[model samples]
Target: MDLIKTDQYGRQIGYVQGANIDFEVGADEADSINDFEIELKRWNWDGSIRYGTRVFSPDTEYGGIVREISTDTSTNVIRAKGDTWRGMMTKKIIQPLSGQDYATASGELNSIIKSKIEAEYPGLFYGVTADTGVTVNNYQFDRYCTLHAGLVKMLKSVGYRLDIRYQEGDVGMAGYVKVSAVPINDLSSEYELTNDNNMNFITDDNRRGINHLICLGKGDLKDRLVIHLYADQNGTISQTQQYFKGAEEIAAIYDSSGSERDDLIKNGIKELESKKSSMSYNMTMTKLEGNIDLGDIVGGKDYLTGISMKKPIGRKIWTISSGKEKVVYKLEGET
Candidate 1:
């Protein structure tokens, strides 16, 4: 019989006594194939046993090296929903106003105004619209006013719909001023001045520039102004009312008669310089009405010369004469 040890699966785990064991036993006792024992010893010839260290001296037999069909049924095949397969998702909180240190509220207001226009009008985002109004006459002095003036001019230059209002009153162009912060959804209290009315004053012989521009020019000369004046007051004077055809027209006119239009242009420049010399007022507009951003207050030229009052300055009080009637004219949007 072929003697060998194997599990029920017919897979051998260990060998039984050598195939020739029984045959060797049946041989003569003396010469009984001592080669079988020698062969077994040779098979187990480990260096550890050679050095007097028993290598495989087990305390008990392990049931002849079982193969048991494993009965375990333990998982070896990985399932689709295995522990290794995990779903991963992520979330983050991104701050809209983070990282920029030099960002200003006024700057934000400017951007907001521009964005609103860009969104509202898709194709006409640029190209000069009609001159809403001459800046010299409608110039604003307060911070918000100054900001709005610049904003309107900028938007107008790029073909944005910013319908500026103008008015005239008993005292020249009274109520002919528009001043306001760019409307932001976050802030409820935003300063805005939108008055389209009229004021009364002297209609001068020269129709070159606005009254304020003329007021800035202290005196008229043969071809220029002798002395400059302050044009701080904010109102739409009559002279600088109409707009030139365009920059192209102005350029064409300049090219056609190089020194011919000098009289008109020089006169206009003088008036503008005078108006620019007028006092400038600044104001702090913020979401928190109580606290103004200190950084926004900086000194400028020809105006009040320094940061405007932290609080709003009341309307400028003026008296034509010592005993003249005290006319209470409150300039709207005075900062």
Candidate 2:
């Protein structure tokens, strides 16, 4: 319930009322909750403060950049605006760039985040975290478009999330941009939605029939991504046929013709299915704590629907607003 403003170096400059801070802090989208934004408003403020005077609530620990400054010198009217740390990255649209073959492993990915990306874009990353141990697969990039798009696509393809950890990072690190590889719905926390607790629960059944995917690759070998072992292609997908019948065919940027292409192909199918198959549940928790952010797993119950979700599910916070601060979450599991 507090909003503090800081200078470019994160030194406290001033503070604002909690009501003046309005933010959409959750990755509410189905699976690609890549980023979130915050907005601060004030009736009268210092216009001479200049740029880089950031503001953010201590809850997120993520600093925001003062990008927009509105002022009328004649009337002495003024206003200033800013966005969260991730907002800075989304604006950095990358151009079409091609690169030679590169090996992508858990360690290599972390190295890229720490060295290459962080070097190019300073003050964005803090450190890396536990990654699913996978083989060193040869991969290449051709026109990533943007860091956000490329990073999310690559991470989602591998059945993982490029989670943004706002608090509690590496031992020596003391800033933002701590990325982690967290599997979706790796439900680890549990919660109960009693009649008086849960505001409401909504369920959605994906009937687009995009349950299966035909992942295609590129180059002379026409390197196709292998997905049979990791995902179901013939049984569960082929069984249903109503609209957009059968499997969903998609194209991928295949750069190599090695056995390692398995990761690429598998990731492609998983990325699609992550959005295609399965039911989605959304519930409003009356109160959300600072610890409950993106990439955390929790469970809830909907007694009215008579649908008692058996297992705990991974969820992402989509929205956070003041005045009782109604928080909404998108659940990732079966109901």
Best candidate, lDDT-wise?
A: 2
Of the candidates shown, which would achieve the greatest TM-score relative to the real structure? 2
Off by over 4 Å in 2: 26-44, 59-62, 71-79, 93-106, 128-136, 139-145, 153-160, 163-177, 180-185, 192-196, 204-235, 238-280, 288-290, 308-335
Model 1, 134: alpha-carbon shift in Å? 22
Writing each residue's lDDT as its tens digit, candidate 1 over 1-335 gives 12233333223334333211211110111212111111122333222112111111011101111111111125321111100000000011112245643222232333444443334334222223323332222222223222223343443333332222112123221121121222112111242311111221111122232333322222234543332122222422234434332331111111112233345446545545543323333322112223221111111122222222112211222112222322222222332
TM-scores for all predictions: 0.17, 0.57
Residue-level lDDT of model 2, residues 1-335, one tens digit each, is: 45555656555656654333344433322343333343323444544344776565553534465676665666554555555555555555444435633323234454444544575567656546444663224433335345554554555556554555444224333335465555555343445554566357665544443444444444344344433312233224322243342245322232334435556555555565564545566665546544554545555555556544422233333333453444455444322
lDDT, residue 270, model 1 = 55
Every candidate's lDDT: 0.24, 0.47
TM-score of candidate 1 relative to the true fold? 0.17
For model 1, give the 10-residue run with minimal summed lDDT.
81-90
lDDT (Cα, 0-100) at 181 in candidate 1: 27
Model 1 has an lDDT value of: 0.24
